[model samples]
Target: MASAPLNEVCLAALTLSIVFLTILWYKLTSNISHKEESRLPPGPRGLPIVGFLTFLRPNLHHQLTELSQHYGPIYKLWLGSKLCVVLNSPSLAKEVVRDQDSVFANRDPPIAGLVATYGGIDIGFSPYGSYWRDMRKLFVREMLSNRNLEASYSLRRHEVRKTIRNVHTKIGNLINIFELACVTKMNVVMSTMFDSNFVEKHRIDGAEFRELVVKFLQVMGKPNISDFFPMLARFDLQGIQKEMEAVLKSVDSILDPAINERMKMLSEGEIWGKGKKDFLQILLELMEQKDIEISVDLVKIKAILVDIMIGGTDTTITTIEWVMTELLNNPEIMGKVQRELKDVVGMNNIVEESHIPNLHYLDAVLKETLRLHPALPLLLPKRPSQSAVVGGYTIPKGTKVFLNVYAIHRDPQVWESPLEFQPERFLNSTNLDYAGNNMKYLPFGSGRRVCAGLPLAEKILMLILASLLHSYDWKLPEGENVDLSEEFGLVIKKSKSLFAIPTPRLPNFELYQ
Candidate 1:
């Protein structure tokens, strides 16, 4: 009788515990259901698993803008297993890039970008962290500081003058503007990185380099099924990852020898010409220093170099081509730019960087060009570290985000004539600039991940654009017209190559030499 009573007591205790656990689980699930009832942003409900994958087009920026129209400024879409959010309005952009910048600063790099950036260690593709901060700080202070740029001025000037001479030789003949700009910009980038002597020795600005840059960018912008479905990434079905790997290897081959040579020279205690450190030397020195807070390595250095090389050459060249195209399309605008060039930089004299400051009209023209055609229309993809509320909607953790600056720049509500090529809008606006402070006009993006090379890019772009207009009088080939059609990529480019005839306008032919 005693044992029987003890067994009943044990069974009763077990039954009570099971009842308690069930109540707890029911309460937790009910709370979760209430929380998720209406939290997700409004969006289209596509077909079962693949989602909106079939509706995408090659012009991703344009397509995203269209989607924003239907779903409002902030909307979510399911692409395969991925959840993507598109931000269209300026206020929403500010919210993410400013108020929640640190939360959204991380990059969800595509497979191709991961390979191109050495597993996303470069500043462009790296995650937001101490390492990224240190790398960017080093790049800004040591590589692209005003002092460093001044030291490398001779290299930039030499290449630009050489371009002027080359164009003079091709006077009255059809000149491919893209090719001309790409070669000159590549030379400037290489010379700045490794000094002009090293660049000349390696012939780093050859056609091969040009082809590689174009292909690399094309691959970067290409959409892959692997990106949409992570499970399929390892299979390499699209070959994008493999292609990027080959490109990175080729880039490595070019940069490796130059790096080794610089390291060797540094070991022997040799100084660069006039004791001025080129980009490579400075980076190598940082790598050797043990006292610094951040550690540097060959992979990081090469990744940075690749970022500079591709970013410097491709974007600058594309912008130059677009500026030329716009000017050609609107001859009156072209005349105005030429007249300003003549007034600021005399017809008898060649253009110089010093004259750039006085060319206000030219500055307006450049702002206008980027306003219409930001090199990076989508401004690279960003991701959230954790679930957060943005624009009154909950964005779940790790959703791919695209800030459509292209659409923001062309918003009819903000601009007077959004489609027109009017440079006057930016004339006196102090707030609107490449600084990325103004949400409405972020051609180079904004926030912690804003472009680090804007200063260098501004100087080079102004110098090159001014020089081309000042030294040469350009016209479309006879019976030909300007094509405003665009072909989008990592950098937006004109579908048709600009072929223009040039005539030297300088009074002194000796300047060509």
Candidate 2:
């Protein structure tokens, strides 16, 4: 009986080995034939089962740049089952974003994003189709048009002044610059999102909103194993999905009541003649319209609101932090900016929207800051709607494509002294505007999915930087140096919080108040 059992065990072991070998052989042949037929981009052949997933590190942008050097500009990597293609050169970036834009407009959003964006129905992650186009049109033409943004200037001005006042009280103490900017951005975005009367009557907690944004960004930036291996997505081993759901719930708790109140007010004609209706009021008005093809439901309204709040706050703050960081590190640049501000708006006067056009150097400083440290370094990942050829390599349908704007901005072939932080590079260059026509310096990306918030983002960023710099002189804490090191996530921020002391710079003390 023992001999018979041993023979059966041996036979089972042999059968398993044969099956494994047969499967391996079939996969090898199929991949070989596919490669010959597909002409796939060159890339590293990672380990058999896991691929390059385990080799990925923090600061993914830097890692991808390094890979570009070894594998040429356009390359592919098997990140588990997903095939990701990274485009490092401007030409290739243009090919995906401009040449074949429609084919590559859809987003392969992470699981966390889908949850946060109400199943990816928002402008950020919605698939490329009529729905996406309609939402984008609503956002660009109606919500963030110059008319609306101009009307909302007072809201921005008020929040920025409040931040200046708060900073004035904390003079001579170490202040966290990122935190300061974060609060100011959050308040400005909230004020602009809803009318003052609504915010005041609804008693929406700004602090709670800030906390929610922080948590949401944190979870969104985390690398979930589920994203790499879709088979594990249902498991959500990292709890990212759960965290995102909780954030959405919190977001809805605040937004739902406010939206309902706004709707109720609109029903009774309470919002008419309310000093230029705010974004929330405008969206509510659109929601009730029966003539439009795309019905603006409550979820769509809330999702767009979330997009403005989260997208507006984080990118604005991150860019401001980088601008301040770059200025602090390069004192001469900082001095030049201050001198320009003083000349443009006189030391006695405050920064106004009209003054922005004349502050050319300050504008260049912002451009250079974005060049060196774009908020979304790699930009949001895109997916092709169908099989397409990019850089002469076949990008199969549904491959994750990353236009490495970080690398393109720093390419020596394109930029002179690519690594330097010289704002002068952009001083008189009208060709390098943020409109995405110039593919080499796409800090805000290009093509159909370029940042729709560009108009509002630019206004707030310029206002914040001008206000802070013109009002206060910033210095690093005693015995400390400005660290330009970065921490990469959904957005790239300084690896460490920038702590600085501020002294009122203007001759007029009352300006701060």
Candidate 3:
């Protein structure tokens, strides 16, 4: 009887093992079939688990371009288990940014953006719901309206003049144009946002606020492995979150006092009519309204400051630096732009908003520079809140959608000699404008969430470039040609900091003497 029982137990164990194996096989096959049936846009097959994570180089734009050539315009790649669909062609980009605008309006929940802006309460990372709409409306009405533009014009003009003066002082010496551009842009942004020229104050720490701004941007822009693979995200593999949190704390520490003082002034009604009604004042006034009960928190204030600093300063500086780099590389185009500025602005006076419309060639050079090197080349990653079809492929809900503005801008089919630095291409096209209507050149992006500071940014860029060219001639550093190589981040900065020697030019001088 004991031997018989033992044989029965052995048989039952074998049967159970077989059943487990069969179930596992069925599940594995079903998963494979479902994955296959999804029919995601074609891409290079990546390894299991990691999924193209290893193939991504530091220069994301080049990598994406190479992949686009192989996998057509619209392609899908797996960033770990998450599906990232990259839209490469202009037509496809238009469909996502325009035709299906609302569908892809949401932002991906990257840890960096979350930490930097306190969980997407800021305008940039905020979702496409009521909060986003209200914040955007406030941003446009308070920060970027025509009255604000007029009030801020003198500040911008003064900043540009100071930039020219600084560059002229460093004439004939190799200067870091990147730093110059960054400082100039920050000064302008600060003056507009805070009603104070903090850059002008000589602090012992040497522009502590500006340095903090740079640190914040660097930390926010740095790539985090956690953002890609959630499994590793739990480990904080790259320590990106820690770094972001530290930087956020530092930034908050710096801005808290200023915010509190401003709040006090607003409560006492002493801030409104005292200054020219800067961005912070406007936001405070709006917050006082019964309809808009904007919370008075360090996070909300810091978030707004982040928007102003990152959105206003970084893009402006990058655009100016790139335009100057291109001009230094191709002196002839630079000469043309200078000539236009001289003729339009008369060189004795500063370039005003009125002069911008007349300087067509200068506009073209700016447009082309933007085309060749968009400030935010990838143009802020967006995700789908719901399932949708793009280019006949089903993009499932919660899929990260990257509108590859860099790739689309460089598409050979859409642009003639896409790789070349040709500003004249824009001069001939009427369809190209920066108002988000033009799908071809989206330097400031398009759709409902297009950059709120577009008008202000354009004015600043035009005025700053015009003033610089109007006052000085730019040349590359000694023994080095202008480097066109690019570096990747939230913003696409030049690989090498743009180093140039500015030579003060005679008013209206067209040629370097």
- Best-performing candidate as measured by lDDT: 2
Score every model by TM-score.
Answer: 0.90, 0.92, 0.87
The superposed Cα distance between candidate 1 and the true structure at residue 434, in angstroms, equals 0.7
Residue pairs with backbone atoms closer than 3 Å in model 3 (clashes): none
Over 4 Å off in model 3, which ranges? 1-37, 197-206, 231-235, 271-275, 291-298, 506-513
In TM-score terms, which candidate is top? 2
**Could you tell which candidate, 1 or 3, scores higher by lDDT?**
1
In each prediction, how many residue pairs overlap at the backbone (N, C-alpha, C within less than 3 A)?
Answer: 0, 0, 0
lDDT for residue 465 in candidate 1, whole number 0-100: 88
- Candidate 2: Cα lDDT at 55: 91
Candidate 2 local lDDT, 1-513, one digit each (tens): 889999999999989966664554345334334663469899988865457888988989999999999999999987766788999998898898888999999999999989999999999999999999999999898888888777778878888898999999998998998999999998888888885556777788888889989998888888888887675689888888998998889999989998888788788976442466578888888888888767899999999998998876788898998999999999999999999999999899988887888889999999999999988888999998888998788988878899899999889999999999999989878889887889888988889999989998888889889989998899997789889898888888889988889999998888888
Task: Please give, for residues 1-513, the per-residue lDDT of candidate 1 as tens digits.
Answer: 899989999999988955664454344324323464379788878654567888778777888888888989999887866778889999999999999999999988899989998998899889899999999998998788888888877878888998999998888999999988898898778777888887777676567767888888888878898888776689899899998999899898888998998889889987775765578888999999998777999999998998888766778999999999899888898889999988988877877777888999989999999999999898888999987889999887778998999989999987889999999898889899898989999999999999988889998999888899888888998799889887777778888899999988788998787
**TM-score computed on alpha carbons, candidate 3:** 0.87
| Model 1 alpha-carbon miss at residue 57, Å | 1.8
